[model samples]
Target: MSLPKSRLLVIGCVWPEPNSSAAGSRMLQLLQFFLAENYKITFVTTSARSEFAVDLEKMNITSEVIKMNHPSFDEMLKRISPDLVLFDRFMTEEQFGWRVDEICPEAVKILDTEDLHFLRKTRIEAFKKNIPAEEIYFDADITKREIASIYRCDLSLIISEVEMKLLQKEFNIPQNLLHYLPFLLEPISEEEKLSLPAFKNRKDFISIGNFLHEPNWNAVLYLKEKIWPLIRQELPDAKLNIYGSYPSQKIWNLHNEKEGFIVQGRAENAEIVMKNAKVCLAPIQFGAGLKGKLIQAMQCGTPSITTAIGAEGIAGALDWNGFITNQPKDFAQKAVQLYSEENLWENSAENGFRIINSRFNKEAFQHKLSERLLNLIQNIATYRQKNFIGKMLQHHQHRSTYFMAKFIEEKEKR
Candidate 1:
């Protein structure tokens, strides 16, 4: 008899837009792993496809549109009967997790929390209020739901070691249930590094991210109001170019060529722009997970001067690609130093290559994850048994969410 094909189902909060957001790039990386393993993957999302959304079909992945809080989803789950179901974010899991639990009891439930939403929310709130982020706690309503989702799932992929530690130390999530899976990137070769724009060839200070992300927009505001003036004061000739996708008119309003604080909207080619830039500045005041622009800066052999928050999770014990300072004055000073000082710039850029190679070896992570998946598949019952809290949450929360969803579905029908 022929063996059955291995199947996987992925529920995305939005269609992948690798060019538009780091989250999108991370999702694509996850897809590449399953593709390499020859898994038959189906991606389902309620989100309408945007022009920027990646064409999964072209990549040999099937995508289907599914409705939220509806019976049709249950039928779709039964029809596919996947070996694994991965939720893109906590919200997606909250909506469809119960159905997956009820329909495909044997399927491994994986929650890929791009970042701890609660932490991001907490930081953003704190930053806006001009207070310390420590004010936020785990008892928030979103925290309750997110942690419960983590417990109920077979495994959750955390992008940062800091977050993985946070889950274990603060929330008491089991080590087995949370895996630290940062950006799975291939190691950069010496040839690749040499090919990147040299310190002499690159110019200007660049920062790039998805403007739709609140933290990125906030960083742009921070640069304009507090950070840029200080830097531009000392190096009057240097320009600070802000590039991002989906920039609104408000972002456009910030553009002033006279001041050289150019709001260059939506990069045509992210890598090309990064490679040509002298220094990348990401003075992020708030957010969670690793920042993609910082990683790209390193990949393109560009040094960066970011904050403690911006450098979080990605730097590990190693020295940062450039500098990490929370103070506005110091941040601006470092940006100038990095842009003008060739020795510092080259050293910082090399440090980035080191971090990427040491921390995010794609092949190593993929092998380990594959092994863990196989073990989980073989011992699903026993694994679930150990997670008693998960079972409890699944039992009670599942029923509550199911009825709530049913009521909404019925209301829609009426």
Candidate 2:
């Protein structure tokens, strides 16, 4: 017998690997949220993985592997007949949006845009050298595809409020189509804070991020080239350990155990390393959404010093757990000051805990999120009626993306 329509099909670009990337962590959290709301989740992915996959069996969630750039996914999706289909990112939607529209028209489609790819790319370009006016105005091909994917979906879960505003003020996307949702997290308990390794116990400076991301790789390069030299001149004994997953031979060559620069690849437990470290340095010149490393640092009671771009739209009105600086010399100086001063480090760390509790608490946002989802589902017809622009965009996408995907599918068969 066909199950009653209470299933959510989350089509991921890849399987969830909470330890490997922030995108993975966000996917797991969304699964948990729906689970709490009493919905069965079917997670579908195309990317193969060996290391660091979320245990779906443990969560009682069913997992399925779908073929990429193929029509087999349509058959798999049709068999499930989900009430709601959530696309993990814009690319996933671009690949499967038309198929979902055809196979499960009644299913409410949702796009979870892990982060705005165009924003990240634009920022990276600007940070590279002098940002040009034409560069900002330059047509980003990804934005068109992403925005079109959003139009095809019933709603999009936007991680960054800044992105939400940009979509509204700049692109003029209707408010009904976009919903702001950050990383929903449990507030750190007072007892948990007390149990964490204190500032005095933890020693040395650390910069940790996933190596797959270019921004992180660039940040590490910045530290090695510009920042570390200045920092070492002041604190000669201070050691800087770079921790991340997937360190290429290029990254490995930077390891100087003698000079107190160690490139430790793929930390078994990020929290363990974070807790043991006195300070986290994320001189990320450019990126979108929140930085998971910064959040983890806060969770582990380790203060961080990041760039203005690194700290973007994360803490809201709350004071940062550490300083934000762009200048290499100032950043290095602050690193020494934050590392040496116990009172400063403690205060900053406490501030981080407060930011997490206030900004990203799961319990705080879960009820509101559920209510929003319910509103979208219940009044979807009216919502769609009001969103004439989305309807027009969707109509055009059906003509454009539909034919494009069909062409690709046909070419693949040959």
* Alpha carbon lDDT of each predicted model: 0.90, 0.86
**Cα deviation of 258, candidate 1, in Å:** 0.2
Query: Tens-digit lDDT track for model 2 on 1-414?
Result: 122348899999988988878887898899988888888888888888546888997999998788876888878877888899999999988777777887888888899999887788777777676784237624777777787778778899998878898889878888888888999988999999999998779889999988999999999999999999888888889899999988898999999977789999999988899999999999998889888899889999999999987898788888999899999989999999999999999999999999999999788678777877888888888888887777787777678878887798899888
Model 1 lDDT on a 0 to 1 scale: 0.90
Single out the weakest 10-residue window by summed lDDT for candidate 1. Answer: 1-10
lDDT digits (tens) for residues 1-414 of candidate 1: 111338899999999999889999999999999888788899999998888888999999999889998899999888889989999999998888889989998889999999999888888888778876666655578788899899999999999998998889988888999888999999999999999989999889998999889999989999999989998899999898899999999999999998999999988889999999999989898899999999988888999988889999998899999999999999988888888889988999999999989988998999888877777877889999999999999999888998899899989999
In model 2, which residue pairs have backbone atoms overlapping below 3 Å? Answer: 185-362
Give the winner by TM-score.
1
Per-residue lDDT of 26 in model 1: 97
Model 2 lDDT on a 0 to 1 scale: 0.86
